[model samples]
Target chain A: MTPPPSATRPGAAALGLAGLLGLLLTVEVLPRSGVVSADYLPPTSRIVRALAVELNDRAFWRALGDTLTGWALGLAIAVVAGVVAGVLIGSVPFLRAATASTIEFLRPIPSVALIPLAVLLFGTGLGSTLLLVVYAAFWQVLVQVLYGIQDVDPVTRDTARSYNLGTWARVRHVLWPTALPYVMTGVRLAASVALILAITAELVIGSPGLGSRIAVAQTSQAVPEMYALIMIAGLLGLLINLAARTVERRALFWHQSVRGEAVL
Target chain B: MLDVRGLRKIYGGHGREVEALRDLTFTLDPGELVCLVGPSGCGKTTLLKCVAGLLAPTSGEVLLDGSPVTGPRPGMAVVFQEYSRSLFPWMRVRDNVELPLRQKKSLGRQRRHALVEDALEAVGLTASAGAYPWQLSGGMQQRVAIARALAYEPEVLLMDEPFAAVDAQTRAGLEDLVRKLWQERGMTILFVTHDIDEAVYLGQRVLTLSASPTVVQDELKITLPHERDQLESRADARFAELRTHVYAQIRAAGTRPAPTA
Candidate 1:
C-alpha cells in the first residue's frame, strides 16, 4: 500500500525552517535591489552582523536580563493569584455570580491603556514593566482557570462528595487534578502575553529591556542595530513559546489529551 | 441500616418545574444487597442521589443508621455509572483508590496501604494499580472505580448503573464480582440499573421503580441460591421465570403518569 516509498514527507520543523530562510533571503535581496531603502529596512545579512556586535556588549545582556526578570516575576504572581482566586470563585456559586460581570469588564480593558496610570504610579522603572506584564497576563490565566474548574466532571464531584472527602481533601484530590491541564494551557498562553507586555512596556515607557534598546537604536539612526534588536525580541518570543509548550507537556504527562498526541 | 423515606424531588426553578421522583420509600438492612431496577427516565439516578446524600429530597429524608443524612455521610461511598467521568484520569489506579481514605482520619499510613492493596486485589487489579485510569480498558476502568469504593470501607456502597457501559461479558463478570464482594465483605449495597436481568442476577432482592413522577412499583425477594454462576445460575429455569416476571412488571410500569393540572 505504500506509494513508491521513494520519498519521505518533510517534517513540520523543516518546513518552518525553509519558510524562515526564504523570508530572510527576500529581506537580504530587497534592500540591495533598492526595492526597500537600506536606511530603514537593512538587509538581513547586515542585521545579522549587527546582532553579532550587540551580543558581545554587556549593556545588551543587561537589557535582556531586565526583560526576562519582568516577564518571570509578573507571570509567577499572576499565576498564583489567578489559580487561588479562580478556585475560590469557581467553587462558590455566589462568588462566581458576584464577580462574573466585573471580570468580564476588567479583562477586556487593554493593558497598554494602563500605561499612563502605571507611569504616574511607578515612573519608568521595573515596576512600570511589571504592572503592564502582570495586568496583561493575569486575565489569561484567570479565565482559563475558571473554565477548567467549570469543566470538572459532575459525576466525579458527586463521587468525591459522597465519599465524605473534606473540603480541602476534595480540592486537592479531585478538583486540582481536573483543573491542572487547563492551568497548563493558561500558563502557556499567559507566558506569550507576558512577554509581549514586557517588551511593550519597555519600548513605550523606556523601562530598560530589548524593546527600549530597539527604541534607542531608532532614535540614534542606527538602522541595522535597530533591526537586530527587533530580531532579538522576535527570537525571545519564540524561545518562550517553545519553553512553555515543553513545560506543559511534562506537567500534564498523565492527562489524556496530552498523552494522546502523536510524538513528532 | 439505610432508609429512604417518602423521598420526593422536583427539578428546575422557573415555570419549568419537572417532577423527577414522587413519594418513593425504601430501606436496606445491614449486610443486605438490594437492586433498584427501572426503565429509562424513571428517575433512578435521582433516587440514588438522594439516598447517597448527593441530592436533597423535596419532601422527605434519607436516614443512615437512624441519623438523618443531610449531606454525604462519612459512612457511605458511591460508584457512579460513567467510569470515565468518575475516576480522575490523572491519578493512577492505586492513588484513585487510596485518595478517599484520606478522609478517614483515623486511618494510618500502614492501614491505608493495606486497604488499598486488599481492595485492588479484590478487584483483580493489582497489576493495573500503577496505570492511569484512561490507560486501561473501559471494563478495567470500572473495576478501578469499584476498587476505590471497596477501599473506602464504607458501611453502604451506592452503585448507579455501575456496569451499564461495559460489554455483555464484562457486565456478567462485574455482576458476579458484586455478589462475591457483598458475600465476602458483608456490607450493604444499593445497586441501581435499568437492566432487569442484571438485577435478577446480582441482587438478593429487587425493587422496581415506575416512570416519573416516580414511585417504587413492586418489590421481589430473589429465591435463587446465594452462590450464583454466570452460566449455571442464569440457565436455571427459575432465573428465566424471575427475569420474565421483572420484564413484565417494568414494561407495565414504564408509562408516564397522567399530567395533573
Candidate 2:
C-alpha cells in the first residue's frame, strides 16, 4: 500500500534537513571550534566566503564547466560502450567464454594506472581526461550489465517468445526493462567513479578543471582557496550521486523495493 | 485448431540423457478447453513449451491451423505461473496488456486501446489499469498476466499452473474468471496443472500424463454441464465421478509398476 502523503513529505524533508545540518556542522562548527589546523582544512565560514569569491571568477566557472563536460561526456561514452559490449558478450555464450579470459585480464588493470599511456596518446586535454574517465567507469558498468542480462528470468524470456515477439522486440520490451534497474545501479556507480576520475585525471595531468585548480591553489599556498576547491569537488560528487538516485527513483517506482511493500 | 503429435524431448548431460517427453499426442479444436494433469517433473511443462513453440521437440511436431509449428507462432500466447515476472514490472497494467498489440502492428491506436480495455474489464482489472503488477496482490497480478495474454487475442492460450501461486479462494475465483473468458471468447486453451480437481473443474477434457518420460496416459471427456458453479459442481455426482476417475488415474500412476518386455 502507498504511504500516506502527509506523513511521507514531512518525514522526507526532516531527513534531508538533518543530513544538510550534519554536513554543515562537519564543515563549519567543528573547524570554528579550533578542533584541527584551519590552515589545512579551514573553517566552513572561510570556505563559504572563498566559494562566493570564486563563484564570480570567470576562470573558476570555466574550470567547473570543463570538469562537468568531461564527466558527462565520459559517462555517456561509458554507458553506450559498456551496455553494447555487455549485451553482445552476455547474449553470446561462446564469445563470453572466449572473452572471459581477456576481460578478466583487462578488467583488473586500474584505469589510474593507464594515465601514463593515455597522456602519451592524447596529451593533456579534454580528450585525454574523458578517455581516462571512460576507462575507469566502463568496466564497472560492463560487468553489471553483463550480470544483469544474464540474470533475466528464463520464464519471462520464454513468455515473450511464446507471444511471437521477435528477438529485438523481446530485448527491447522484456530484457531492457528487466535489466534496467541493474543497469541504472551500475550507471549510478559509474557516475560517482567518473567524477572521481575526472578530478583525478585533472590533478594528475594538470588539465583545466577543478582538480587542476585545487592543485594550483595548493602550490600557490592559498589554503582557503584549496579548501574551497576541495569542498566544491565534494559537492560535485554529492550532486552527481543525488541526481542519479532521483532519476532511478522516478524511473523504477514500480520496483518492489521502491514501492516499499512485500509481495505476498 | 491445434495438434501435437509424438512430441519428444531429451536433455543431454554428462554421460546421461534425460527423456523429458516421449511420444505424446493430443489435439484440440477451436473453442476447446483442455486441462493437462500430471505428477511433478512429468514433463507437462515441456509438452506445453513444445506446443507453444518455445522448445523444439527432439523427434515430433506440433501443428497449429494445419501448419507445422516451427517457431513461436503469433496465434498463441502463454501465461506463466510466475505472474510477477511475466509482466514487465516497469510498465503500467494498460501498457503491459497493450504490448502484444504493439507486436502485431496491424491495429491502430484506437483499436489497441479498445482491446486492452476489453481484456482488462473482462478480467475485472479495469480499476487497476494504472497500477504496476508488483503493486497488486498475487491473484490480481495473475489476472493482469491473463489479461495480457487475452489482449493478444491469440487463437490458443497456454496456461502453466497459472493459479497455483494464489490463495485457495482466489484460485477458485480465477478458475471461474477463466471459464467465463473461455466460454465468451471461444479461445482454445491448454492448461497444465498438478491438481487433479482443478483439472476436472476447468477442463472440457482432462489429459493425464504418466511420470518420467511422460506419455499421455489417458484423455477423459468432462461430461459435466457447461454452466457449472464452484459449490454445485464440486458436489454434483458427475463432478465427483470425474474427479474420482482423475485422482485414481494419478494414484495408479504413482503406484503402477513399469511395463517390461
TM-score of chain B of each: 0.97, 0.97
The DockQ for candidate 1, computed on C-alphas, is 0.56
lDDT of 2 by residue, A1-264 (tens): 566465568888798889988886797766677887777777778878988899999999999999999999999999999999988898899989989899899988888898998799889998889888998899888988888888878888887777777778878887777778888899999999999999999999987899999999999988888888888999899999989988988787877757787444
What is the C-alpha lDDT profile of model 1 across A1-264, one tens digit per residue?
A: 122222355576588789999999999999999999998789999999999999999999999999999999999999999999999998899999999999999999999999999999999999999999899999988998899889878888888888787889878887888888889989999999999999999999999998899899999999999989888899999999989988987788777656763222
| All candidates: interface RMSD | 4.1, 2.4
Model 1 C-alpha lDDT per residue in residues B75-145, reported as the tens digit of each score: 88899999988888778889899988977889999999999999999999999888888888888899999
TM-score of each: 0.94, 0.90
In terms of lDDT, the poorest run of 10 residues in model 1 chain A is: A1-10
TM-score of chain A of 1: 0.94
Reference-based TM-score, model 2: 0.90
Q: What is the total number of backbone clashes in candidate 2?
A: 0
